[model samples]
Target: MTRDKNKKKPPAVQQEKLNPRELNTEENKHSNHPLLDTASAEIKKYLHDLIEEFKDVLLIQVRQDIKKLIKEMTSPAQENTDGRTEEIRKEREASEEEFKHNLEYMKQIQREYQETQNSIEYWQNALTETKDNLLKLEERFRAYERERKSLLKITRNQKEAILKLEDDKKIHNLRIKNVSEEAGTSKNEIQKIFTEILKQNFPRIAKRNDIQIKEAYRTPATYNQNRSTPRHIIIEIPEIHQKNRILKAARERMQVTYNGKSIKITADLSTQTLKSRREWGEIFQVLKEKNMQPKFIYPSKLSLKINEEIRYFQDKEELWEFVATNPTLQRALKDITEKERKRYQDYSYSGREASVNGADHGMRE
Candidate 1:
């Protein structure tokens, strides 16, 4: 079962000619052969062991390969997903190479068939068995493809759901940006600064102490920059109404400043929501350039109000498809389509493998 990569088969054995057509009359001729049944049993055993060995490794490889494929598909950035995508590509290449090697081994069996003429039924069975292995690989590959598509759909939905949940959690949370990123800064200092900003802009609620800060801290992940501080403080309060009140006070005030430095107060959004909003921002600008106005309904709905009726775009594909049909955005959509295709070109699969072995296979690959 072990093959020395550099080792060559014996010339006499390698060149042995085999008449596979003997299979047509094999049952008639081998019916009376004494050794036929024993040889058939041995061949079947060899095939069973070989197939079982390969199947175990193949199933494991397919599991890992499909996981990588799903990860690559779900990632938003093509540049970063290359490593996992390459893992999938290598898996397929390995599968193809193994398939080719197995095919060659099957051919060796065919060539050796003449040696088993006295036991023709056994040789026939060996040929039949080798082909089943090939068909097994083909069948598994098809299953992998089906599973990949199903996982991708499920993952996309899950990502959207996770983002929605995260946004919901932050309903009672607000963020402060462009504040000091100084080390050794305490939460009390941040809380004090925020209270002053709120008390100035929102006297009614600030006087009543309705805007209470349960906890406040500077975000941990920060980059040091000479020109500006990196970290922003996040203030967590108890009630959604208090959070809403703070947001409304900031909006009502034309500008909110702390320690003579301008501070921005905004609703805390999940990374997914921010990314979606960023992408939509560009699309909105594109619409504006076309002399068309698009409405962004809160929580990720893009719509066009035409004749007092709203036409909604649920996702990027729908929005782009609508754009491409519009006379104004057609040119831009063409470029976008080409970019998207190029970005995802690596995800394509041919679903091909080496040819099946044996002269005649009813168990088709």
Candidate 2:
């Protein structure tokens, strides 16, 4: 193209793009200043392009970092929410299990309480029944006590009447003891043997043969060869006066004999009367030793000259009471009274027995 002088002419380097590195070469250093301007412009353009590229790269990196930071922050919050939900679910499950266990425990307590109530009711019913039975037993026992007392009174009265009838059958009898028994002896021969005894012992009596014998016989007993003593004979006198006379004569002699053998003559009384007479022997001896002039009145009555008066005692209690009034008798019989008191307490015999003995003691030969 033709150069246009009227306008400003462009540089030759400026007509083409230039490398900034080419301007620094030795060849270009010698070239025109316009080339430097072109190089500077190219350098500026390259710097601007580099700056834009770096900015784009930095912006992309910053965007990626922001997304990563936002992901980091948001992911942790979601995880925390998930973990909290799981923990809440587990807590709720544990609470439900605990509640179930508590409910079962409360049910067991209710069952035990019901059983306790049932047991208490059973014991209360049993106690009420036992109390009722005890009341019934007490009532029955009182009734039995009254009946027993009534029966005791009736038994005591019946016993007294029986003893009195037994003594009346033995009133007018005389017995001989230790008479030698001869074999083949008859009742008539027994009578003759007694007649001879009266004749031999009572020869001084006026008309001793006039003492009539109602009957005479050996007492009923089985004969034994080993017997040490002979059996006794009974002499029943028809007249009471004659019996008394024979007794008086026999007592004065103090010794009666038959066929050169000693024998005894005594009133034949009931066993009860004999026992009663034997009991009076101790008191009789005591009174006789004291010079009281004691004597037997009848079956068992003791007649003692106490203070110049005769006193009758029905029992040991009566005698003990009588002795209490007299100092000399009490002192003399203190040991005997103590022994009798001990025996009385031990035997515990009712006064009815002594009264019965007293009622029956009036019979005598």
Candidate 3:
């Protein structure tokens, strides 16, 4: 056994134990090794301070740059806002000026329209007044025309009346001349006889006569020469009657005798013989000269023959007196004269028509 034990004896364990100073010294030595200790101290103290200083400088720089950027952006925006406001003001002023010009133009047009209306009114009134004046003038003209027509009618009637009076006077004078010549006496003697006859038949006409009578006698030789034949004595008679009476006396005395007829105191007759027949023609000639024919005195030819038969008795004083006293004969004579005057007047107005009708219906016809 012992032999085996020798082979296994472990080496004696040596345990070293040091003082505190010695242990501290060894620890320091290990920690103070050049690379290890110096490197650690430098990193903690110097490097950490440098990094803090750099971070502060970077923060100050960033703040300054941001302030400058803010000032630059705000200045430009403010200027643009001011410029936009001024532009809007100018546009408003221009619009106001345009509106004022339009208002003035409208007023001018209104004034012109009013003046034109006044002119139209004035012309219309003038036309109305002119029309009224024309109507008044037309009425006056009509009144004047009516008065002129009335005056013309009055003048025509007066003219006809005057013409009728003149004709009666002329006929009366002619009858007086015929009576004086046939009576074979002075005009005064014929006037006296007519006056006496007028006194008996128409006393009014006889009283107005201013006449005288003278005797008339035939020569002895003249009486003896015609003694074998019936004595032809003409007696003077005055024309004292009106025109109508004288015409009637002449008409009553008118005769166509086969033989000699006796002479009435109022009218003369031809001799009582065949040669005396020629005297009847002379009586008709006298009637024609006086513008009185048998047709004019009588309405029909038959009445004219009857009148001639009644006149055969030439010595009928009553018949002669009746003719001398008639009044209508004068009216017939006057009508003839008026017709002649009107014929001439009508010839001037209506030409030939007036003349022809006047002649056909006149007293002379």
Give the best candidate by TM-score.
2
Task: In candidate 2, list every pair of residues with a backbone clash.
Answer: none
Off by over 4 Å in 1: 1-155, 182-184, 204-208, 221-228, 248-254, 286-299, 311-314, 324-365
Task: Give one digit per residue, the lDDT tens place, for model 3 in 12-100.
Answer: 33434646697568557675656545545665655566557556666878777877787788778878877877787787778778778
Error of 1 at 227 (Å): 9.6
Between candidates 2 and 3, the one scoring higher on TM-score is 2
lDDT per prediction?
Answer: 0.67, 0.69, 0.44
Give the true-structure RMSD of model 1: 48.3
Query: Which run of 10 residues does model 1 get worst, by summed lDDT?
Result: 351-360
Give the range of the ten consecutive residues with the poorest summed lDDT in model 2. Answer: 1-10
TM-score of 3: 0.25
- Local accuracy of candidate 1 as per-residue lDDT tens digits, 178-226: 7766522477887887878777667787789766788787776455565
Clashes of each: 0, 0, 10
List ranges where model 3 is wrong by over 4 Å.
1-102, 163-365
Ranking by lDDT: 2, 1, 3
